[model samples]
Target: MIETLAKLVSTKIKTGVTQKELGARINMKQPQIAKIERMHTLPSFSTLTRYAAALDLSIKMTVESIIK
Candidate 1:
């Protein structure tokens, strides 16, 4: 789950917005975002919810998609 989300947040998708931008939007610190993106920080329940909202994805859908 963590890895997939990180992959989705690669530099390629960092054009219109970067990790720092998204982190600010979600009220998470840049380091927190980086750690999450690097699979170093496991997201909390609320963090996951916020991430889904920010990425415009349903938590269930996002999680299910990463079930591999």
Candidate 2:
């Protein structure tokens, strides 16, 4: 889930939004979000929920697929 979210984050970055701004939208600390995207850390379920919401994706179903 973090990996897919990171891909979207890369898209957001290319579109000119900073990590700080992206983190703000998802209510995460910038460094926390950064670590997840860099694959240095895994995000919690709630955090992934927030990220999925922020990224306009289906959290439950999609992640079940990912986990499987």
Candidate 3:
């Protein structure tokens, strides 16, 4: 799931924005964005949300009860 999200962010960034630009939008550093794009480190949920928002994307999570 995380890799998927990271890939999405990376793809959007490739559309013209640089990692540094994204970092500025999210108040992060270019290296941090690079790490995320490369999946070298896992980003926190809030960080992922911020990343998505900066790219004009949205994230939705659903939890369902498990019954045996």
Candidate 4:
């Protein structure tokens, strides 16, 4: 799930924004953003929310019932 979210963020960043630009928006370093985009490090929930907000996006989560 995290990997998927990372991929989505990466793709959106590539669309019209650079990593450095995004980092600045989120008060993070470019390398750190790169690490997150590449999935080298998993971003904390707070960081994820910040990232999404930086891109004017939102994060949504869904839960599935295995018992079903």
How many backbone clashes does every candidate have? Answer: 0, 0, 0, 0
> Compared with the true structure, what per-residue lDDT tens digits does model 1 show for residues 1-68?
75547545753275466778788879988899889877797877678768767767545543356566
Model 4, span 1-68: residue lDDT tens: 57656665776657788889889999999999889877798888888888888877777778899995
| Better by TM-score, candidate 3 or 1 | 3
Q: What does candidate 1 score on TM?
A: 0.65
Please identify which of the two predictions, 3 or 4, would achieve the higher lDDT against the true structure.
Answer: 3
Pairs that collide, model 2: none
Give per-residue CA lDDT, model 3, range 1-68, as digits (tens). 66657566766757788889889999999999889778898888898889888888777888888985
Tens-place lDDT per residue, model 2, 1-68, is 75667666766777777778879998778898889778788777777777666756645543345564
Query: Runs in model 1 with CA error above 4 Å?
Result: 3-15, 61-68
Error of 2 at 20 (Å): 0.6
Runs of candidate 2 with Cα error greater than 4 angstroms are 62-68
Error of 3 at 26 (Å): 0.2
Best by lDDT: 3
What are the lDDT scores of the predictions, listed in order? 0.70, 0.73, 0.82, 0.80
Candidate 3 weakest lDDT stretch, 10 residues: 4-13
Find the number of clashing residue pairs for candidate 4: 0
